[model samples]
Target chain A: MLTPPETEPLTPEDRTLMGPGPSEVHPRVLRVMSAPLVGHLDDSFIEIMNEVQDLLRYVFQTENQWAIPVSGTGSAAMEAAFANVVEPGDTVLVPTNGYFGGRMASMAERAGGEVAYVDAPWGEPLKPAVVEDAFHQHDPDIFGFVHAETSTGALQPNVPELTDIAHEHGAYVIADSVTSLGGVEFRVDEWDIDVAYSGAQKCLSCPPGASPLTLNDRTMEKVLNRDTEVRSWYLDLSLLEGYWGDDRSYHHTAPITNIYALREALQLVAEEGLEARWERHEAMATQLKQGLEALGLELNPEDEYWLPSLNAVRIPDGIDESALLSDMQADHNLEVASGLGDLEGEIIRIGCMGYSARTSNIELVLYALEDALRNQGYEP
Target chain B: MLTPPETEPLTPEDRTLMGPGPSEVHPRVLRVMSAPLVGHLDDSFIEIMNEVQDLLRYVFQTENQWAIPVSGTGSAAMEAAFANVVEPGDTVLVPTNGYFGGRMASMAERAGGEVAYVDAPWGEPLKPAVVEDAFHQHDPDIFGFVHAETSTGALQPNVPELTDIAHEHGAYVIADSVTSLGGVEFRVDEWDIDVAYSGAQKCLSCPPGASPLTLNDRTMEKVLNRDTEVRSWYLDLSLLEGYWGDDRSYHHTAPITNIYALREALQLVAEEGLEARWERHEAMATQLKQGLEALGLELNPEDEYWLPSLNAVRIPDGIDESALLSDMQADHNLEVASGLGDLEGEIIRIGCMGYSARTSNIELVLYALEDALRNQGYEP
Candidate 1:
């Protein structure tokens, strides 16, 4: 028998979360996490599941009946979209502009699809003309693009144009709305996206266990008619349909408490209408952007393509990014993230999302950044 | 624009949870779920991750270095175990005794492995002689068996004997300890289990998001040198190693609140001590069994193979199983489960694990069951 190690009590420090994701959760959502669990198949839980699907439809601005929470984090939903839709030998077109598009290529490849790229530089959105060229070049069966790139802090403009190109080429379009849903403006039906997936921890401000995914009828029909079984039995959409569809049968045990937290988070989304929520995020991020500019920093993305939920600020010369982040954490109990993938060490990401998009959090982030800059012997 | 559906406040009825799994979360676990969020890569969150690993090692009674929580529920962890370890064209052996074994076959097949089975009837443990015969007949590369079969309320006795057979045949042993970890007697190292996976909602009494998985070094070596990419990228162990291993790098975003709950639940396990906790489960379940026997009900499994955490009571003739379950819920707000798969409609499953293994909960189950039986006009 192994001797148990003595672990101290869990008392995590309460910090102002303004990171790239996992924005601070609403108090109501947090409280709901403490609620006792009902069995995953309980009638009440099934009702809760229905309401979540309904709310997800509202957020996506669609009437797709396949809106539901996948039982994992954002990447699971992303994989679910690709793994189910992209069949063997299918040509998949993905953008090379941001981190998540590379992820889509990986998932599509793992799903036995041939991957083709639509190239755009880092921190820039894809041009409709470039996408059309790629579709014409590859005649891809599936097209995936990031609506809001968390790594680049760029939001794709002219979504309808991109979707129109895919549709004209007889392709399905998948949108990575991870950092945009419930915060930035996005429309699934109007934009004609076949499938869209988002994380709960980002703009929804729920914990990251269950993630939202929606698929229109055409996409789900392809999934249902796949010649080969989905390589992942746990994420196979055909198997999951029995549980989430009208049958309400058993597939697997869901994260009951996470569902409760997500429901409360979506309820808050409904209470404060979607358009108002988007405006609040933009207004707060604009304040943060102005403050960073006053401190002699430059935002990475262009004005027209800026992502309001995730603000990527270019690090100034002679400033140690690691030291700046540590100083802010030590002095103000504040959190902002270093850039990911291609932008690592070149930028800092500060988020204004859902519950964390208030004036108080934005002010604290600005004050802490200024303090950290002064401590680093840089006059900004 | 889609109109948002009006959702009522979340007010799920509180019930005494005693089912196959998710047997009543500990109060400490539930309280910690409401704590503030931390970045998945935060230093403090990393420390908590270390503590959770240490506690999991203690409970598993293993000093293996590759113990960590998978980011999704139990099935995800189960898939993680198979999808990484079983290479293409490998012949994997699993038991045909319970519901989970069939699931194992599905996962192994999905991992590009051919599956063979050792035969055993439902509600009975796999015999060591039969396992040895199967190994000799099929020459499998991997063998998986359930340590505690949740669906049939049977526990495999003589675990070392089974592992010995597999080892002599040069086969890796995987144990499904979903219904046994932290409450029943399960020692991964002692039983020579190369891999073991479990759910948090089971014996750990945490919520059902993040799950526990451990692999010994020899097993991980096979995984790191896999011939093909693991089918599921989200569950790829080589990728997960960058996050949970010494690197502490980013994988996908973890379910932060679920990790908090798992840590608290494992801390409770550490405080109680594993042996003491196991004895408590056995004692409480004994009381429940005695009460049911007095009421003229019969448990399905023989005493030697009976699982203390889950009791499978044979349904009496002339009694409607569904109505009995409904009455128990509608009258007392108590949650017990009908049997699954092979045992469906023939038995009722009452769980006695973790926080639900108290004398008070056992008494309540007995009282509620008696009332439900009386309401069904089945006097005993």
Candidate 2:
């Protein structure tokens, strides 16, 4: 083995993360960031790990015993949900509105599921009636959708109704709450979301790493009774339960420090109260919308269906999108993402998620964008 | 949704870890543990992440473009390797000499590969000749084996020879170097290992959240040209390369703080040359072996094949293993594991790896074990 070459010391600029995810981590969370590392199964670390599980349950609004953070990021959690529930030959109905929904469809397909996509435009929500029609036509075993479409800035409404339709046709609902969980109101149990998974980086005001996943008893039973073993042995909840469960048997080594950061972030959420957190995000998003509208920018989606955490705004004609992002990074030390797939070069996604949901930060980003557009000779 | 009930804080004894992993994390690594949480794609954090990648390449002994850390622990890396390479119906040959080897077989099988195991007992090394025989018989597409068998305490010799056999059969070699990479001598490129992966907690002395994985051009070509899409969307290297490769695109949110700890750990290893680190671990293991033998304890495997990192010693007759373990914890705050699977209760696994590979720690653990065995009515 060779030695790593010497390099410069890490000097982080305090940038407000307002992209799709990895929202600005709270300063308190950052302050506790250097806590001493403890063994994964050590008593103290496991205590914190347990606290994280508890915090995740509270945030997810679920009493499920299997509520725990998946080791990888949000995608890992999504994979875990699909791997456990959608075995080979299972028919899974997936909504294709945003990138993540398409990801769910692809993952389901890979899990050997016959995927039936309930199509929706990129910037539109999945209509409950359309899902009902799909259910009547396909009668799938699982229904999957993104609660908050990060890519298209569309927040699906009538989730409880959609889940009801899925249940009426004997299907479990898998919700991707990656961008919605802590930033917006999500009634997991009330909505009959059999499986809901979230990423910590989005609304938890933490870095991306852990995915908080919760499952109802029905989902767990399905996982238990799966005919074929789950394709991913690593993400298999059965083996992981031994480690994250009461037994605390060795699985893969848990990322101890990342868990600490999530714990701190979740504690901040608890202190703020989940509902209050949602209100704060909503209020800040309103402020951002007002500011962006004041700058004569058009929002991606109309009211009620739009996601509050991530606001996708159409780029005005003749505006250099890449240059605007570069300017934001260089001048304001801010980051806003460009759209993906079809939306690419058409919209700039400005996220007000987690700690970045502050009114001041939103105003700063809006002002910066306004300046960049004007400087680039684009009408704002 | 209900929150998990608040529980009492977990109290952890400061135990000296002596197991396959995670060996005792360096105290300095723990002290620097809580570096401020930065966004995964933050410039400064990305700089650190790049450094970590560079360090990983160093430890992997390769300039392979794909050398980087996977978000999950060691097993996740193993899954990533197989999920990226072994598509459905592909033939994967795995060694079954120890626990990890068996795990590989199961993971590969789940990945839709027809897994063929080259048989060896738990406490024995995989015979190169036998492996070659299996290669001739199966002519497998993928050859997988553990370089260091943690369960059996057997260090597989003849890495070059095995790689030659696999390559001769037109197979790409995926080496599970989890317990060998940093603690022992492993030349990934030299041994013609197409894909190699390792756990950070074992030899790197970092808390286990990430696993380092590397692949040469040969393996990358397989991943790039796979006929079927990789089953796992999360573990898929194609998308991961965008995030970890030069482009630095968004994949999932990486575990930022864990990467920080790993970078620091890798820096420590770099500061102390790789050869020096290997010698340190070897010397520490020799000391432990000498001390154990002096206490009339017998190592499970023959001297020639014993692993330096994980030492499996048979429990002397009439010794209460549980009581001895309990006494070690209660009296000395030391953690030495009981065996895994078939070896359970029949042996005690003592580790001398990474930051735990110190003469003083070995002596302390030895003294504690001696007291524990004597207290359990063993005539030591």
Highest lDDT scorer: 1
Which portions of model 2 show Cα errors greater than 4 Å? A1-3, A31-33, A43-46, A378-380, B1-4, B7-13, B31-33, B37-49
Each candidate's lDDT (Cα)? 0.94, 0.84
lDDT of 2 by residue, A110-195 (tens): 88899998989889998888888898889899999888999989899989889889888889999999999999999887788999
**Which pairs clash in model 2?**
A33-B34, A34-B34, A61-B1
- What candidate 2 keeps of the native contacts, as a fraction, is 0.61
**What is every candidate's C-alpha DockQ against the true complex, given to 2 decimals?**
0.87, 0.54
Which TM-score values does chain B get in all models? 0.99, 0.97
Distance (Å) between predicted and true CA of B218, model 2?
1.4
Report the error of model 2 at residue A5, Å: 2.9
Model 2's alpha-carbon lDDT is 0.84
Candidate 1 chain B worst ten-residue window by lDDT: B19-28
Q: Can you tell me the DockQ of model 2?
A: 0.54
